[model samples]
Structure formats: C-alpha cells, structure tokens
Target: MLKREEVESLVEKPAPQFVRDVLEHPPFRVTPNTTLETLVSYLRKFPVDVVPVFKSVFSDEIAGVVYPHTGLLIKSKKLDVKIRDFINSPIIVKESWKIDNVLEILASEAKWGAVVIDEEGKYVGVVTLRGLLSALLLREPKAKSVAAVYTPVEEKKSRVGYVKAIERLSKIFKKLAGGEVEGYVVLNREGGVAGLLTVWDLIKSRRWFKGGGEPRPIFGRGAARGEGRAVGVARVWRLMFRGVAVASPDTPVDEVARYMATTGLYLVPVVDKEGKAIGAVTAWDVIYAYLYGPKEGREDVEVKRAVEIPVAKPQVEEAIRLRPSRHVTGLRARDVMLTDIPAVNMRDTLSRIRKVFLRTGSNILAVVDDEGRVVGFVTRRDYVTYIAEKSLGYWKRQKGKWLILREQAMPGEQAKVLVEEGTAADVMKSEYPTASPDTTVEEIAYKMLAAGTDYVVIVDEKNAPIGVVTKDELLKAFKERGRSVKVGELMTPADIASAELFSSLFSVIRKINAYELDGVVVKEGGDIRGIVTVDDLSLRPVEESLRGERLVFFTKSGVLRRVRAGLSRLRYSKAGALMALDVMRPFDHATNPDADAREVVDRLLEQGVLPVVGDDGRLIGVLNKMDVVKELARVYITYAMPERLKEAERVEVKSK
Candidate 1:
C-alpha cells in the first residue's frame, strides 16, 4: 500500500499544459487503396498496430484508422481487398486542446489512439495509449506494492487444470467473454501455477482459421499436418503458453505493470513463497490503484484529496447541481436508450439471432412476445455458450461422427446448423433487469452494475420494450467529467525481457513465446545491439503455407530480404545456425524520463513500444499501448461519474 505522504504527493501533482506540447509527427500513413495483404506485411515488419488511412498518399484529409488484427481474422482468400473496407472512424483531437480535456476525450472514445490535427484541421501526428502511459511513467514518483492492487485469486473464479480436455475449456472462455470472470489461471498436477490464458490466446490459436471457420491444414515435408486433428483432441496445455511472468504480493505494482505493457501479457499471477498462485494483478487493477489509490483502506484518503485538489467549490457545486435528479434536470432512460437494436422472438433460432447480432453489432437484444412485450433478454455471449455446449454434447455422443462432420462441413455451415437447432428460449435470461423510460441515468448505471448485467431494457407502461441502455451509453453520458489528470499519475515502471546478441534464433523464439512478447532487446556484454520481434521471425505464415518457407537475410545496406528455403532443410538447419543480429533491427526510438507524457504518447503512436532513457542515456523502462489504455479507463471511471464510484465499490465487494 502507498504511504500517506506518497498518496498525498500523487494527488497534488499539477496537470500538463495542452496537447500541442506533446504532439508527435505521424510515423506513416497509407492510402485507402492499400491492400489487406500489404498492410499485414507492413504491420508484421513494423511495430505499429494501427495505421491512419488517407484518401490518397498526398491527401491531407483523414479517412480512418485500420487495425490489422481484424483483417488477419479474415479466412477468405481475398487478401487483395482494400483497407477502406476495414477502416474505423478515427477519434479526432486538436493540438491546442488542454491535456485534461484530451484525456477525457480519449478515455470516452475508448479507441487504441486518437488522430491529432492542427487549427487548420491538417494532420500533425497521432497520440496513442502507449504514448500517454510513457508520458505518465516519466513523472511518476514513489511506487506501490502489487498486494495493494491485485484482485484476490478467489474472486477470479476462472481456473482450469492443464490436462483438461479442449471441449471443456469453452465454458470458461465463454465466462471470460461475458465479463463473468476476470481471467483464467491454469494449474498443474500439484496445484502449482502452470500457465495463464486470456481471450487473446484463443484468438491467436484460431489465427489459421479464416473467420472462425475450419482449420486449413498445410502439407509439406517436415511440416506438421495434423493441426486439424490436434484441435479436436488437444488438452488445455496445448493452448496455454508456459513460462508466464509471475509476481509476489510484495512486488511493486509498477514493475508488474511494466512487464505486462512491454510483454503483451495483461494478467500476472501473484504466487506465494511455495510457488502456488494466490491472486492475480491485471492492468485494470493497476489503473484502479493509480486513480483511487490502494484498495487496502486508503481510497478514502486518496479520493478526498483528489476531489478537493483539482476541483474547486464552484465546480463541485455545479457538479452537485447537475447530478441526475429523479424528477428532472438530467438524462433519463428515454434520452440515452438505444431503440434500433433488433429484438428476437422466443421461437427464433440461434442462427437468426447470430445473424441479427452480426448485422447490428449490438451485444444485447430483447426477447419479445407476439404482443411486442419484452419477456427476457439474450446476449451475444448466450449464443456463444450455446454453440460451445452443443459442440461438447456432440463430441460426447458421436466423437467419430463429429470429427467426420467437422471435416466435411463447409467453412461455417456446421456451426450454423448447431445454432439453427436451438431456439431463443433455450438461452434467454428471463429475470433480466428492466427500467422505466423516465428512469435517470444514475439509477440505470447503479441497477446494471449492482445486478451484474450489461444492459437494461427500457419499457413502456404496458411492458413493451421501447429502448435499451447498455454500459456504453451510460459511459457516453458522463464522458466529459474527467479533469486535471496527467499521464505521470498512470504509467507503470518498466520491466522488459532481454537476450544476448549471440543467442540462437531457436532460443530467442522460445523466450518470446514463453513470455508472450512481441519482441526482445538484443544486447552485447555491457552494450545494446538491436531488437528482434515476431515480425522478423515470420514463422506463422510460413508454417501455414505449403509453399517454400522464407528465410530473412539482411543486405550490406541493412535492408531486409526474404529467401525461400525448402521446409525440411529450413526446419532442421536454421534453428541452431541463425543468430539474433541476423534478423534484428536497429533500435532507434527513445524518450527522456523528464519529458512531457505527450512526447512519449506521440512516440508510442508511431512505434509500438518506447524505451525510456535517463540523463546518462541508459534504458530505464518501457511502455506499451495496452497499459496506457487501462490507465485511461481508470481515469474515465473515477472522474466521469464520481458520485457513482462509491456504489461501484459496493458492487465489486458484493460480487467478490
């Protein structure tokens, strides 16, 4: 837990100036005509996760940002599809805006990053979550212990045995997707921590399948061709990555956060002296600590100090005056409720519900009767759970037939058939929470959180569903409440993985996979050499393709080139012979520990990770986009609706 003095000091820090002070130059932008395959290859080679889309290479007006992971999930052979087809509107912010205001905007927008423009609306650069976190770490003072912030193991309730069958893992995953559990802690035979699993691991495992379809088996000499067979019968151990980074209860919160940010692993298991998992610290836990201070009897002091410091009497009075009233003055269910979400009938098939969800992008839908009165609620998670349970039943009754059916079924037809067999009534929750059209947003938020439901139906006097309010709408209503916050108050301490320059490619790959890292810093004795990332390895695509595998070679001019090699020869020879320097790129991006957080945010927007350097130019820490977003979310929840936080705390305690 943070000492009283430390908490006070954090609470008193002043906000940074404006967005212009930390503006970054856009690293690279692409035209809308850029192909998905081209973008994938570019992302593989570069560290950037999102690329800004312009009408053309020379045009100044922005289109949107393209995230490559979504495109990677496309199972179709149409790699030549234009990026315009995958674009999402970018969150636009101005360089002249104050830092507090911009922070509120980004937090409310809930995007990976926001695009920055000048007074003339000309693109200047981008500010990303990573950059925000890097900026925050630069100004951070004393650190707090993980025990002060980590969610206890008992509260997670998503554990699995390493040897559990693949069929049984789906239920736990469904819980995770539904927000019923935080994450899964995989335990070994002796009950020791074996590994960790999250939704990302599931996504990564299905990368070979296009659009959640059947696996495409690759055939070649020395190539593993039984991937389809393995998927059917593999144990949890096959999907869970080992060598997970762990933390003790006493470890500093920032240290664990830094490891998570840089390594791409969000949850770190908290183990005891006996190496048994006791609890877990996630990015959210760390952010909550930064915003409201430690959970161990210190939040009162922190919240009081934070509220009194930046907010003046007039602002507080105004806030109180503007608070939602039962009679009038603020938004109610009718004002914020979404009326366009599709409704399903009790007799509707899961297949039709799935189609409606896909078409509308709405997670929650109302189940209505022939009279148009809502009887229950169904969610995307319900459909997912139903399919998983159905698959498990099929595997138990006709394991041989199921495997044969899977192999013969068209890409998505088998899954469709499973859903078609079930009706909406089979998975609907009849006791879902509901609210009147006149209910205030405050009441609605409290109801949803307290009831552990994502949405509430807004019904008419006759009990007919008219509109619905989900967490998103509630958040949107109070998005502008955050103020006087800075990046320094949110960033974690830097702790990253490193390897020797002479390390074999095989050893490096093993280390990367074990830690689930995007890359590692390669160094010589007492000196830094370069960095190597998953993009440099190019193992996934090569392993998936039946054609010749490509080996990376650097020219004398330091340019990277790919040379095709036979699968057998490449597999047997390169593992031991190749070295880190053979594929490593020169490390160029670095930020000062004393610089404004915006500078780091700018750098991070351009580069996936930023290395923090001290006055002496030695590496101090690293920051990534995921950790920054977690911090931003903390700011959003705490400041946007301060009055609701106390009730939220009660809900969390009761749920535990």
Candidate 2:
C-alpha cells in the first residue's frame, strides 16, 4: 500500500525460522543432466541419501530430489541413465516457511531431504537432517523424549539373510515393524553382516521405469527337469550396497558418533570381535546423550534417561529398592506385566482390525473387555492361519475352478459365511497370561518362556489393562548375563541331519519334520554342499507349472480336472523339477558355536535354527529360537534375576 522504499522500510528484514537458516551456506545440488556416475559421486560427498536436482546450470531452479538408493535398486542399464530419470519433485516451499512444518516432511520415512525454493521458484538450497542437526548443535536437545533418541537392538534383531528382492523380505519387515525392528540385516552364507537395508533404501524400490530388460527366464539354471522355462524372481544382491561396518559395545561413544556422522548412517550396528552384531546405536542417541543426558530428572518436564528401564520406580523408593532386599524374593504376577497394549473391539471385522495394524504398525493385538481388562490376544499370524484354514475348508467343499468361479461370483454364497464371522472374538486367543503391574518379572518370564508367547498383559487394581511386557524387555533384564554367555553354553549340541542334494523333495521334508530339527543340509559325498529349509517343500503342488499359453493350450482352457492335470503336456513342461536341490534355495544364514549367545539368539529368533559351525566350519549343533528362549528363561530366572534384585535393592537404598 506504500511506496517501494517506504514499504521496504516498514516491513522488517526477513528472518528464517525454516531451512533457510541452516542453508545459509549454499548447499549441494545436482542437475537433471547429471550422470549416474557423477551424481553418485556427489551424493557420497554429502552426508545425505538424496540430493536436490536443479532445473539447469543458469536458472538455479529446483525441479526435484534425486535419491542415490534408486541407483542401487536398478538392475538395467540405459547407457544414458541420468539424474532426471529418478528425481522426485520435492514438496515445494516458500522462503518464509516454518521449521515445524518443514520437519514433518524431512521426518517422513519416505522423505529425508528436500529442496528449498524461493517464492519465485528459484532453487535456493537443499536442507537435510545433517544440516538440521548441525544448525541445532547450539541448542540442547534436553526436551526430546528418551525413546526418540535411544536405539537398542535386542538379541533378536541381529537376524540376517542373503540379499533378496525387498518383496521377499516384506513380511518379516512388517512383523518387525510392529515392534522395534532393525531394518534389513544382510548376512552372507556364513552369518556375517554383509549389507544393510533400511526403509529409506526401499522407498524407491520401483523397477527402473519402463526400463529395458527381458523377463528373466525361469529355470535358467540348467535344471534337469525344465528344458526351457522362467522360474526365478529378481534378487537384490548386486543392488545392495555392501561392506558392513559394525561397532562393539565397548567402542567409545564418540567413535560411534564420528563413524555415523561421516557415513551418514542412522544406525550403526555393534558387533563382536567375530563380526556378530550385538546391538545398535543411532546418531540421535549420541546427540541426546552428549547434549542433554546430564539434565535428566530435573523435575521441569518428564524426562526419560539414557536407560528408561522397563521397571521404572519412584525416585525415593527407587533408590531405596536398589539396596539389599532382605524380604523373600519369590517372583509375583505383576513386575513384568505389559502396561501398554494395542487392542481392538470384539465385533470388529478383519478389515477394521487391519486398520489398527496399519495405524500402529504392530503385529500383535490384545482384545480387551469393556473395562479395558485383558480378554484375548491376536497377531498377524493368527489371521493368516485362520484364512488358510478357512480356504482349506472351502476348497474341500468346492472341488474345481468352475465351482470356485460360481462361489466367488455371488455374495451370501457358501464362502461368505464363517465361524465367529471373522470377528475379534473369533480370531483372538483367550489363553494368555494376565497380571497386575506389581507381579514379579520372573514369574512372567517363566510363563512367556513356557507358553512361547512374546508378551503378557498388566492389569490395574480395578482389573483394567495398564501395560505389557515383551520378550525383548526380559532380554534386557538379562543384559549383564548376556555379556558372559557363549552360544555353546546355551545350545544343545546335536548331530547335523543331512541328505544328498539330488534327493526327492518329499524325502527331504520327511527328514526335516521327522527329526524335529531346525533344518537339514544338502551334502555331496560326505561334504557339505548347501542348506535347505522346511518352507521349500510346503508350497502349492505342481498343477500350475507352465506359464503363458503352454499349460493353458495343453489343458484346453483349464477344463482338465485336478486328477487329470498330471496327464496333460503341461506336466512335462517343468512339474517334478521339485527335486530337493532344485526346489530349495540355499540357506543364507548361519552361526558358529563359539559366537556370543546374543548373536546366536538373534539368528535363532528367525524361523529356523542356523547351522552351528565348528572351527572347521562343519555343522555340529542346532540352536532353535524357542530352545534358546527356554534355556535362557531357566538360567536367567534362577541365576540372573536374583542378581538384578540385589542391584535393585542397592539402588533403592542409594536413592533413599
């Protein structure tokens, strides 16, 4: 409304409460014409996963963001691949934007780096977490909650596998995401950390757009069974950035900080001398620890100290309890109860329950009563088992494709009805442990170990739900004991079960189940060749063997009956190639007997027991995940809990 000079004088000089503050130092940027080689080199130079893409050299206008991880995911080559092929249009912003809002974008799992543009759309500079942290160094992170900063990897997260497409690893990642899953831990065949894959690495997993490459041929491995076919899925071994870097618990915190800062790693896994991952530390953990750790318990605000123990105590009573407890220490029902539980209602449908799963990103759901008291428990696996059983029942009733079509075509059909109507009350198991918050942690640990459950619920004085105690928490209770333990000490050393590589799949599955073993190995002339898992054989039968028109042509529009399917020409295409060697993918994980108990437990926590190697690298024993839990529970309660009790008493007295 005023003259230009008057308006300029009246309006105060612009100040930045946004990325422009940290971007005062002109940040790094790439151009759409940047080659993959040069772009990758630039990315390595900066401490961020993504780089801003400018429109051109002269304009300095930001077009989008380019992620280096995208390059890692592509298997095809365009001889002419350039930055333009992958840059994502960064959510545009103004020079006067608020940091709180901009942070929402930078904090997203899908986004970590963004380009800041002037109101005119000119590329101002790029802002990243690294820059944010650097700008934030002068301000103490005292108010940040403990969970936001601490990164701990209980023994279970150390599990790893050979590189596979992120799709193959999605289910496991989902299960882990429900809890505190340490992203993808890639291990070579020998069970050593190889490559790491985090959620960010997977954000751009889309196949190179319209990228050139013929579909990989199935059974291209020169199998004796399939003369010509395509069978295999894409793997990410080549795509995964390799060279694992691990730290030890004793490694100085500063050293870990420096390592993470330089590498731009969010997670730095702690490894033992033998290269077994034992724990993990995050970059933020170091920042919070150094800048604000000393200000804990100041009474200004609720503060979670470096170790927010599962069992928190009142300051005065807590210090007193740390002293010796002369009273009898029989474990009660409350100490280890789960105080926080994620639950759904009884009448909730599968679709509704799934909503809760997505929102919370958890696998387990506790069904509760009107009073919020524990009533039942459910997990992602329960839904799968129920669906599989229901499908089996339907298949038993409806025999063929024609019947399946009719049943699926209409509503209120036979498949529409279900026992319990797929309600929470139907799928939830009511046979879980319940206790007050005061129950002895030992009792709960024993129950968890015996029932093979990962958690137990905690109720209040009014019999209402309060919390939940998980297996990982109990593992923390045994933290000190874990340090002194060895895998050989906890595992039941047993002979390795085996069969020849060329054995029939049926025979291999038989041995795997009959021996009640973790898994069996494929051998050649008394020498170890590879490993096989039970999962390889339990898949759908060979009826749908041939792809494209080959099988359809022979079956005459799929009219061939189930019994007659074997007689069709499709049977000759690649059906019985299900020999053990051909059907089984080589086991990608393993551990040695001398490895630490924590590392071994991490591997065992996954579905199968890893092959226990001797110094000579021959399988000698198997450490089942459940078996380890059982043994640890017994030893930990009888041995470890008592010591913790003593320490608790001592701490209690000191506080008093």
Candidate 3:
C-alpha cells in the first residue's frame, strides 16, 4: 500500500494506475449452497461494498456479484434467494489495459467495478467504479460547467404525475423508457414536485409490505401508515412520503456531482418559479459535461403522454366488433413510445456517471451527438470487464499477491477530482442497439428477447435517437389493441423456490434473488400460509431506542387478540434477527386460474399482483400486469400480424 507521502508524490509525478492498485480482494467467501442467513451474517461481519461469489467454498469458478443493495435487501428479507441467483454477472477485464482504457470501459459500460484476470484469464482481484472516478476526479480538478453538463433545457425528462397507481406508473415507465428517462415524479396539485419514484420504489414497497425495515424486522402490523405506496388504490399519492430535492437550470455541474457523491441522489428535478417540474438532471449528465459539450434544440418528445382518443369510424367500429380478440392490429413502435429519447451528447463527461446509475437504475445507456443522433451506448457489464483487466496490469507492476479489500475505501478524494474532469466522448460505445419507429410490436418483441435487453433506442432518418421501445411499452401497445385470453395462457409461473414460514427472513429474502421472483410463497409445513415480496422486506430504520432489551417472538397458536397485545417487544438490527414468516404477507389476494385474463389484468392494475391457484387449490402461478400484456402481445403476434405484413409487402412491391 502506498503511504500518504507516496500518494502525494505519485500525484505530483502523474503516475499511471493499474487494476491491481485498486483491486479489492473480496473479504467474504460464498458458495451456491450458502444459506441466506449465513450470507447475511457474512455481509454484516465483513461490512463491505461488494462481494464476489464463487461456485462454492472449494471451487475457484466465479459466479456473480453481490452489491451493497443486496445486503440491504438481505437485512429486509426482500431479496431472499440463494447466493447463486442473488449475484449479477461480474464484469471481466484483462490485466494489461491502461488506466485510461480501463476507466473508459467502466464509464461507457456504466458499472461500479469489475473482476480482474491475468494473461491466462486467471482471476487476480476486483477493480471498482468509485476507485476509477476518485483517481480521475482527483487528477483533473478544473471540470467546471455543471450547467453545461446537465440535460439541456429540452432533454431532461422525468415523468411527473399528481398521483397514480402502480399500473399507471408502469405505463409511464414504458413510455419514458424510450426517452431513457430514469424515474417518475409525483407532483402536488400545485404542480410542485413532491417526490420521485423509480422501479426501486416498487421493490422497496414489496419489502415494506412485509413489515420489514433496513437491518431489522418488525412483526405485528396493519400495513403501517406513512409507509406510503398504496397498491390497491389508483391514487398514487399514498406511495410517496419522502422529502423532495429540487435543482434549477443554473446549478453548477460539479455541485450536483458532489451532492450525488455524498447524498446518493443521482436524479434531481429541475423546477421553475412556481416549482413545477420542467426537466431533471442525473449524475451521468453531469459527468458527461466533462466529456461532451452540449445539445441545441427544443425537446422533440412529450414528457407526459398525450391522451389521443381516436374517433371511431362506423366501419372501423364494425370491423373491431367483428374481429377476433387475437386479430388485434394497427399499433406500431411509435404509438407506444414516450419519445423522450434517453441519450447524452458525445462531449459529456464520465465523472458524473454515478448519478446516472442511481437515477435510472439501468446499466445500458445511449450516447448521442449535438444533433440528437444516437452515436454510442454504455453498460455496467462492460465496466466490470475493464476493472478485471486493469487489476492484472496493476498486479504485474506491483509484483504483489494479496487481495485488496473494500475495508480500505480507496480512490480517495484525489481520484474523484480527476474523474469529474473526464469527457463522455472518452467512454461511450459507438456501437449500440437501435430501432426504427415503424417497427411492429411482434418484431420489437422478438428483437428485445433476442438482445436480452428491456429497451431499444429508436432513431430517425439521420440515425438520431428519437424514441425507445421497452418491454413495458410493448405490453402497453398490446393492451390498447385489446385481447381476450385465459389466465392460464400468460401468467408468470410461481413454482419458483419457497421457504417455510419459520425460516429466517434472511432465507425468504435469499429466495428472491435466488429464484428471480418478485415474491415467494410461504408455507407452514405442507400448507401455504402466506406470500412474501421484496416490498414487505423494506422499512424506515426503526428507532433503536424503541427496541427493548429482549427479542419478542409471535406464534400462531395463541389467539390473535392476545398476540396483538404483545406485539411491541420484537426489536433488533436487521442482520441478526428476523425470519421469513415474520415478513411474509398473509395469504390474502389470490385468484382462480380459470378467471378471465382481462378480469385478472384489471385486478392486477386495480389492486396488485395476486397468486393464481389451480382447481386443486395449490398456488401455481402469478398474474400481474406484465403477464397479461405479454400474453396479449404473444396472441396477436401468433394470429394477427403475419397477414398484415404480407399485405403491406404486396403494396410496396406493386408501387416499386
């Protein structure tokens, strides 16, 4: 390790950095078979930022990554899953890449860190996004221009609403996905921004529903008030309770970046004199300021979706009445797109990327130029690869064999200064996924499934990104086309893993990541008693002072009234105490598999997701809004569009 003097000397000399210099040898070792409870304890013990997962204690084969967010989920039992499914793919990089090249990879890829490998592709250590940013930001301190770095007046897009349901928010997500919008904004009746909402909000709500809080679990509840986010009601105001943070068009870019680095707030809403939201800025936009210059234009898309109620022609109405449910047609990618176009100019800097990650919670991003043309793309996976490769370079230079640990939070204050100074053109991937507005729903669906991405950028004749198509948007398009299908035809299977009611909340949360289901069935022996979701696993931290000296356990054998009387005693930190049954939602809200798909979909949108049980009365699957929409799309594609395509092709050929 370098001494402060050495660090100072290296700074003065402008010495190059390698992956080894910043590689963190994950302090904890984990395997596929590790229990959620054990993993939670390990995380608590290690108290680190990220952890590497191996196939097992004895195997060297790498699996995926467990981030800090995972730890928080574990504490709340929202991410109950096995170690295997809980981790994300590790970004890998060669050891020989230069520091600049490595930084480029991390930035363009939008990753926090990566696994390092040597010439033989052997694991060396891990390198991180923060480490790289610290080095760069520290080295280059003159990266002013926060105003220029943010989204231009027209490009900032965050969906703002008075109050809406999860279903409504989902629609916004699909729409804004094209614009590459990061989150949804809830405004007061005065049009003043109240709070922000992202997909993470849903995930957090899932945990909160279970009576869980960060680092601890609270049993005995009636869905605590002020916890926000009402799933049953269409009103959205119930979900947003946090304080709003606002920014203006003239706020300096560096100030915003520093705010993000310290507060973890990546998306800041830009408001006018009346406090109505105009645009939003993210950490990525600030970082891009150092990398790219600016864009000139009025935004080409609507931030709020327009409700264009089409007048029905008598012939069209008759045709619609006569058409089969599966024969729905006439919708295109443009019809479903929000058209905000999520892209940054080529001159944007990489330093402000952390804000982007937090704001959008997405790994993939589109890079554009002054003309709003899509020029490149970036993803977190790419950065992981760069970090891995650079670590080897550092290892070779140091001739060292020790693993670096997160306990030594590095890339210190110096690296950050330099990173704030780097440019977006220095990192973005010139090659990326793109689509055309005229693309059909079926075609777009196949494209997304093939690419394994949720969204695709839409470019115009000049190839400038004008919109995006996402799974959510595709679902919206299909629903508007209308459909009649059986619930059995399109539900996501709930046969994913389950945990006993008595299992530690850790075990239930573990199943979340391990199985990839938003929620899981809770069983008491052979009988299903309840369901647990990530929403139930989150809570505002308990006032530790409210906790008593001893643990209080709840049992079903006692009368409900008696148990309710003794409810206040349970109290402790999130990691050590808590069980799945404690955070599981009671066996309420379920539907029969034979219900009409539309009814099921309406139920999903109106109330919330529910379990689908077979005639035998066993939980078989889940019917959510997405499931209904996906089925709608699949049916239309199978029976409706091929002939439409053929007829259109015939017309084109005749014209030619």
Candidate 4:
C-alpha cells in the first residue's frame, strides 16, 4: 500500500556516486625512460589496461600512458627501445566532474582508461570503464533473479541427449562444432541432468596409441606410425565432465556471479526441482544484469508515467514525429547480413550438401526450389542425424545392437549410400525464422531467441533469400552499441597459447584443450606462420574421416600419398604434416591495435580469433567474442538506451 507519489519518488531517486567513487589506484608506475622490455615485464606482472608514466619516480607530473598490448607488440630485437617511443596520450579528467560528464568524455575520447586528477590538476588516480561499472553494480539493490538476464536453454540451442548416447561421439562432435552451440548437456534416462560435454572435452580426449604395435601401412605406404583412435571413437561418458554446476531460476543474480567468479566457471546450467535444465546463467549474463539491471519490467514505469502525465497537443505531435515508425535506429540486417552464403537445390544430393558445408565452412545453408526460391534450410546437424539414422538402420538389419556398434565398427557403407543418394529435401527443415533487410538488429536478436535458431534468412519481396544474419552478426551489433573501445584494450595476451610450426598435432590439441582456447597462433622463429582453431580441427577432417574416405597426404618430397584410413590412423601427425598449409587460414585478416573493437568482432565472426597487430606489423594480442563481450558489459553501464539513441541521432544528423 504505497502512495503514487512514493512510488514515483522511488523510481526517480538520484543514483549513487559514479566517477570518484570508483577510482583505481594503480599498483605501480613507470618512468618515460623505461625500456619496452621493462614495460612488458611490468604489464605481465600486473595486468592493468594502462600504466601511468611519470617524468621521475618522485614526480607526480603525468607524462603519457603505456599498456600491455602495445608493449607486447614490440619486436624482440626492439625491446631495448624506450617507452617514450610508443606512448599514448592519456585522457585526463578532474575528480570533481559529474559522472555523466566523465562518461561523455570517456565515451568520445578515451579507448581503455583515463587519468583522474584533482581540482588543482594533480594526479589522483585512474578510472576504467570496467571499474566504474563494477562500482555501480555493487551499489545496486540485489533483488533480481538470474532468470532476468540468463539466456534460456532454447535460445542457447542446447542439445539434450540421454547418457546412453555416449557412444555417438563422432555424430555429437559434428553437431557441436558445425553450429552456433558449443556445449552439450547429458541427461539420465529420467531426463535429469547427468553431465556436460564441450569442445574442450573432445580435444582433450585425443590420444596416440601407446600400447599397440606398429600399425599396418595402408596400400604398403608409410602410415602415421603412432597414430591412435580419433577423438570421435572415445566414449562420451569418459570424456564428459561428470558433475555439472547448476542454479535455479529463482537464484539471485549476485549469488550466481559470486559462484562463477570463485569457481572460474563461465556457464552455470539453470535447472528445475526435477533437475531439468531450463536455461543457462553465464558470466556475460551476470554482466548484463549488472549493467542493465533486470531485463524485463522496466518499461512498466515508463508506460505508467505516460498515462499519468497530460500531453500538450504540440508535444504529442513532436513526440510522434520523433518516434521511429518502422525499424529503430542502429544497425539493420542489411548492414550485417552475409550475402555470400552457400545455397543448394532441394533436389541436390546429400553428397553435394556435404561438399558445400566443408568447402564453405558453413553450419547452415539455404535449400532452394526450381525457381531459386528458398524452400527450407539444411544444417550440419540435419545431415549428421540423417546419416546416423541410416547407419543405425543398417546395423539393425545385421541384427546388431547400438551398444555393439560402439566396440565393433561403424556402418560406413550405409552413411556413404545416404550421402550418394539422399536429397536435400529429405532432411531440410522447412520452418525457420525470417527477417527483412530493414529489420533492426534488436528485432533480429529477439526473433533468433524466440525461434531457437542461430540464423534468420533475410528475404526479398518475393520470398527469395537475399542474405542471412547469424548469431555472430547480432553479437557484433550488440557490441557496437557499447563504448567504442579499441581492439588492443580488449584482446588477451597471445603468449599463453601458441604452437610451433613443427609441433605435433597431438601437442597442439593438448595445448588448446588445456587452455580452453578456440585457436592458437602458429609461430616460426618468433614470427607468426598462421593460426589454427577448433573449427579447423573438427569440421572437415572429422567429417571426412568418419565417412571412411581416402585422406590425401602430402609428403615433404612433394609427393601425393593417399591413405585409406579413419581418424584413428591419422591421429599421430605433425602440425605441418597433413595439409597444414591448407588447414590454416592465411593471417591476412588481422586488425591494427588501434582499430575499433567492432572491427575485431567482425573479423572474429569469420575467424574464431583475430590477431592485433602494431604499427610495425608485429602481432600484439588476440581478440575473441568473450573479450568483446566483457568490454560491452562495461559500456552498457556507461550509457543507457536513451543515451545511445541520442548518440545515434547525433551521428545521423552529422551524416546528413
């Protein structure tokens, strides 16, 4: 029983302090004379965005700023260079300035952090977007549930299967890596949460045969001597993490965040009382909660306010004129859609579909009719499931049980027959989400989530597919709404996970799995040779191997060697052994350190990780989706929807 005025007061109460309250005192300082090598060491020890540079140790006078990313970019031979040679001008702000004013300055000028000064212009401390957002979240009242910010299980495109499906590891790998989803949830026969499987599990399970004597060479040719079974052959139950951390829908957002931060877990499955996964609470969700508060119910106050207040005729007209009648401001589907995606005819054979998927590295493709009008969509999962079913049927014809197939052999002939005869229309999904070129990114995001799809086909007036927007494009648009941070500011250190040119494939797989990395840079003599990603390891090779095809191998003598083997026989190869040149994509898709993070996101949408290069063309750092998401959370806290709209309008006006 609160009065109307009291409720209004509660809604309009002044927020807590934002700028000075979140000032961060850096652990150390550097002199302008510090060597690039010294700065690199300091950055490694203390992972701060920016380190203050002073004229001397005793002097409080600020010079410039140096960050870890730029320091790492310095060539090994040039480590002796002084810090002054590559310093960035610091954005200075007074402690007395209001939060909004500071935010405006930071949003427009600073890339990573700003130098805080007192009224007398003396250095006080430093303030980063992340620090400010953390302070704001800490001050916020804790009443919201994790559900308010979590991505529902449907939206995550999570695949659920019985624990007994552990034998279908090869098929599972195809589903996991070939689509938007990254993890799989294992359930008991009763549909209770049993375990979890991820790409890390697949990579870690890869092993070389140690006990088996020399394998017989195929066709009397040199075979991979120590090559063992493929990760696809490993039992899923053995590879999957046994226990899963879970949260309830009603769990407090803060509590979930605390657990994730403490346990170093990025995703927590939200389950019901019956132990059924309903959704997932990820670190990004917690960040969203902290920045935007609750996801729903905020519009109710605005609606009520509009109803209570009397609008003047002129004001009403002005509001109507200003409101967007169609698509809202910001990025639209046309701006982010991919026009070069592969499409296939409905009558096309499954073999053609498989070739297209492997050649283009696409998870989904449009299925078109005689008139070239899109009739449906076919995904990697669809193809794999179809082939698996055929194989199972063939095995049953032999009076065999599914359990026996695990220890004996897969029915490769059945899968081959389906690939050679089955048509796209046999397995294509007809009902899918659709959008127009003019649709806003926000609307597309909702459509994707509602439809539980990774992509939405953008169609023309005739319902012909013109372009397609995927989750990667939507994520990029969301990132653009945040502060325009630089790629260098958000990228992770590259040294943590990397591979040498001649390193064993098993070694590379072990490194990537141990670090849970999407990819690792391949370096030769301290120079980047190329990059390898989980997709490179999982997509074409595993699919081709599972089909029992003769894998072509190139010998060091430039001779063509074709080995009719499965994944098990090809496991023990060097990084540069089997089509390494073709396996690794060229490193030409790199971005400069000073490039906008959105640019990095764009590149990462195609490449799992993007290299950040310095002015001298040396690799600085690497960026991924998670890196951008972390910074996006901080930017959301700095600017609300209204502020973002205003900024967009300003840009539009300038464009005009």
Best by lDDT: 4
User: Model 3 over residues 86-162: C-alpha lDDT tens digits?
Assistant: 67777787767766666666556555567788888887777655445444443433334433444533542322323
Q: What is the lDDT of residue 387 in candidate 1?
A: 41
Give me candidate 4's TM-score against the actual structure. 0.29
The C-alpha stretches of model 2 lying farther than 4 A from their native spots are: 1-340, 348-363, 369-374, 380-421, 438-441, 479-483, 492-588, 600-609, 615-618, 636-656
Score candidate 1 by lDDT: 0.52
lDDT on C-alpha atoms for all candidate structures: 0.52, 0.47, 0.48, 0.55
Against the hidden true structure, what lDDT does model 2 obtain?
Answer: 0.47
- At residue 382, give the lDDT of candidate 1: 49
Candidate 2 TM-score, C-alpha based: 0.32
State the local distance difference test value for candidate 4: 0.55
lDDT of 2 by residue, 1-656 (tens): 67898987787544335666755322355678877656544433332544666788766666777654544433344445677777676766565686556655554433545666788777666655544443343344443433333343453433222233344443444432221333555555544455566533433333222244443445555454443323233344533434334444444444444334333445655545465544455544555554555234422224211111121212322211122223223444454344455689877766566556545545478887677666788765455445434432111111111102111111111123112236788778887766676666555655665454556667678865567776544544444243445666555444335656566545554454333334566666545566555322222222222111122111212343232222221221111113444333345576776777665554454435566667777766555543444444554455656788999999999999
Candidate 1 deviant stretches above 4 angstroms: 1-28, 31-33, 76-82, 97-110, 141-143, 152-192, 196-207, 210-236, 264-266, 295-656
Q: Model 2: how far is 490 from its true place, Å?
A: 2.1
lDDT of 4 by residue, 1-656 (tens): 99998898688544436557657776777897888667655544344545789989999898888644455333343326788877778888887776556655654443446888988889988875445433434445233676576666566333333334356665565554432243566665655555666543433332211223344345433455534223334566776654355566666666555444222234566666556667676555565566556666421111000011111222212211222222232677899998877799999876577667656667678898999877888866456545444432111101011111111111111111111256899879898888889876666655654454457889988877788887666666656664566777767666644555555444555454433345677766556778877554534443233223465544323466665433322211110112222234455588877888765565686677787667776666777554543343333323334566899999999999
Task: Sort every candidate by TM-score, greatest first.
Answer: 1, 3, 2, 4
- Each model's backbone clash number: 6, 34, 91, 0
